[model samples]
Target: MVHYADPSMKYKLSRLNLARTDYLFSRDAAEYATYILNTSPIKANEGRKAHLQLLTKCAAALRDILVFGQACTVHRNIKN
Candidate 1:
């Protein structure tokens, strides 16, 4: 039972019986972030096309963030 600072946004998260898996962010936050980044829109019952599109978008975004984030960190460290 995790105590949440915001009562209105309280959620009871449970452990899933899956190997090598962990939760990073909330579902709502993830969806919102995806939308804000203008990634592929996953529609209900959209089939394989939607799935592929989502994967492609996710891969591109992940690469961009990792590359830029690492670059920024290196630059900051060099300056100090």
Candidate 2:
């Protein structure tokens, strides 16, 4: 029982950490996007694209974290 619980606890902690990282990434991405839109010249399409890409990456990371959480839940259920 202890061994089984240990793995589940670890997974839960990992999920929490992933969630926290995702939150920080989202905040940073939003800040960068706002900075680019507000300070960059309208003609600088490249700068806009770069900022958008960063936001996209952050979104993808969040998606992955959610997927991981789902997988962990599924695995835990299966084990039980």
lDDT of candidate 2 over 1-80, digit per residue (tens): 33554668878877999999998899899999999879867863544455646667533344444433343333346666
Query: Which tens-of-lDDT digit does each residue in 1-80 have in candidate 1?
Result: 66778765443232342221434446667789878656665465344344556667533344444443443344356666
Runs in model 1 lying further than 4 Å from the true structure: 1-25, 39-80
Worst 10-residue lDDT window for candidate 2 reads 66-75
Alpha-carbon error at 57 in model 1, in Å?
A: 21
TM-score of 2: 0.37
Winner by TM-score: 2
Per-prediction TM-score = 0.19, 0.37
Residue 42 lDDT in candidate 2: 82
